[model samples]
Target: MDHDNILETNGLNHWFGAGEVRKQALFDINLTLKRGSFTVLMGPSGSGKTTVLTLVGCLRAVQEGSVTLLDRQLNGATEAELVALRRRLGFIFQAHNLHESLTATQNVMMGLQVHRGVSDAKAQTAARHALDLVGLSDRVSYLPANLSGGQKQRVAVARALVGNPALVLADEPTAALDKDSAAEVVDLLKRMGAERGTTTLLVTHDNRILDRADCILTLEDGRIVRVDDRH
Candidate 1:
């Protein structure tokens, strides 16, 4: 494994379902991601893009081949090991996935509370700073129901980044926003990744975000067809 590469996959493959319904989702997928780089995974639905992201993100059990995340093998890692590894990553989903009952600040604080030994005061301070970075300082006390779709997504971004994770896995994070809001979200991810050397692997179908990526990877029928390096 190259230390500079935050993620590496070699001859990776995955399957779903069982018996006659069993189907292959990934085919000999080999990929490498450099630290601090913002990469987009693009393809039509059922192209295995999300599967690749989940494999690298440790969200699913690796079924075949090799996946080295942060220099640790994920193929047969114990559940405890995987749980420990997950603490080092952050995830942003298509839905904001915020707790409706919690204030924006409280939602962001949940990000840090996952890690052991973080005090409530310290978590509050970090959460406030993260919200500020995402331009949500004033909305920290607002509930999810009170915020706009863009503001909700911004809160999700703040929550994902509050831990200062080594890797961020985002799935269609900007899919629900308007043009300007989508741009803001993508640009924010790019800027924060650049500044903190946080590697980002985002899965999206939004064409608008292509230009912001350091690299763009396209998958087709469970295979990588093209890799465009814009940086």
Candidate 2:
């Protein structure tokens, strides 16, 4: 394991279905993300961007190749080990995925619920602070249905960051937002990566996000085709 890298994959490969119908989804995917770096994975649909994200995120088991995350190999890990590793990661999705009945604070608190032993009061306080960081302090009590699309996404961002996870995995987080909202969310993620030393691997096709990335990896036909490092 390289001390500076938060994630590393070598000879990563994947396929769906059994031997006869197995269709390759990823091939020889060798990649790495430096600690606290903000990396974007871009590719067209069916180019296997999400597959890489899922593999590195520990959401799916690694079939072939080696995945070392936070210093642990994922290739033949048990389910229990995967569960513990996942707790150290934060996830954001295009849908926001907030519970409709829960208020912003409550929703954000769910992020901490995954970890055992945090008191309710502490969780609530942390949730509120996270909301404030996202400029939603005044709307902490609002439910998802009551908040604007951007505001809801901000809540999602807060939830993802509330735990101070070592890494964050986001899939098309800005896809449903307007121009301003998308920019706001992207900026917030960058800020978190800078201030909290949080590593991020965001999967997006939106070119707007490219400018904010420290590095961008472009995938095509299950292979990384381009690597752009911006400062």
Candidate 3:
């Protein structure tokens, strides 16, 4: 219940399917992420790294154990409550899932549309500012097809951050970019966390991100086996 912790999980467990086919994907997981901190979840394939992120991000239900996200218990939260909680979270995936028909600004505006009471003018202004923050002021009118891979990812970052969510969940954000572009995206996230106090929990296999993380947790066989604290 501490105000300083953005996310906390105690004895968290997850299972997929049901009946005889039910299979456990996560064991008891205990994790705490402080506000404004940048953390990375790293592990091999099928290691339950994505499971943990989805649980905290409200993308999936917590089967067993407790998960407190943004100070609310997700164990038995209603669907409406989950929808509201999801509005307060920003998610970035390996693929920059921007609408092909929408321009960069229009795509970023989609992020602000989830929050109630945001006028079109306000959304446009915020989108411009967000794109500017990501160093894409000139590309606001550009479509996703016209942009490079890195530019597309930056637009995704801008969209995720435009809402000013309390937490950001990123999964392999830099996977498709080149080395330099990948570094730029990671650095931008770290800088944004410091400036806006936006806690970030990223699941990535990129080693380049480890150096920028305040904490690095390694998951193996559904359990946390190592925690490297750089804070």
Candidate 4:
């Protein structure tokens, strides 16, 4: 791994089942993500983009190779160790995944609750700051149902950032939004990366935001076929 890189995966392979029914989702993948860089992963459906994100986020285990995040090895890491590693990662899914019963501010604060010794006042303060960063200060009191698709996603982003994680993993965050909304969300991501120096890895089919990424990796049939540096 390069000294400047925050994530590195070598000979990473993942497979399911056995014999004739075996399925390979990723194979012989090697990649590096530098700290404070915004990277995007794009591929056709079933091309393993989501799998790569999940693996790096410690949501899935590496079946064949090795994964290192923040200088910690992920392969065969114990449950406790993985949990600790995951605390430095934040994930955003296509569904937003906010609690319908909770307001946007409350939802964002929920992320801070995972860490010990964080008081409610501190959590709420952090959540408000995150929402403000994402341009959602006014919507903090709204519930998921009261918000638009993009607003809901911004709240999700707020939740992701509230923890001040070293890495942010987003899975097709614009999938459920309109064109204008999608662009808005992508712009917000760009601003966040530029201003905060947070490492962001977004898995998306949207090509419009490709130019905004500092690095782009394309995957096909479970392998990284190409890497591009836009900066």
What are the root-mean-square deviations of the candidates from the true structure over C-alphas?
Answer: 0.9, 0.9, 0.8, 1.3
lDDT of 3 by residue, 1-231 (tens): 799998999999999999999999999999999998999999999999998988898889888999998889999999898999999999999999999999999999999988999999999999999999999999999999999999999999999999999999999999999999999998898988899999999999999768899999999999999999997
Tell me the whole-model lDDT of each prediction, alpha carbons only.
0.93, 0.93, 0.94, 0.88
For each candidate, give its TM-score against the true structure: 0.98, 0.98, 0.98, 0.95
In candidate 1 the C-alpha lDDT for residue 20 amounts to 100
After superposition, which runs of candidate 2 have C-alpha atoms over 4 Å from their true positions? none
Task: Encode model 2's per-residue lDDT on 1-231: one tens digit a residue.
Answer: 888899999999999899799899998998899888999999999999999989888889999999999999999999899999999999999999999999999999999988899999999999999999999999999999999999999999999999989999999999999989999998988888789888999999888878899999999999999999897
- Looking at candidate 2, the ten consecutive residues that score lowest on lDDT are 188-197
Task: For residues 1-231, write the lDDT of model 4, one tens digit per residue.
Answer: 676788999999998789999998898988888878888998999999988988899988777888989999999988898899888888888999999999999999988876889999999999999999888989889999999888999899889889988889999998889988888887776777677767889999988778778889999899889989887
Residue 2 in model 1: shift from native, Å? Answer: 1.4
Model 2 TM-score is 0.98
Local error of candidate 1 at residue 68 (angstroms): 0.5
**Model 4 regions lying over 4 Å from their true place:** none
lDDT for residue 165 in candidate 4, whole number 0-100 = 86
As for candidate 4, its clashing pairs are none
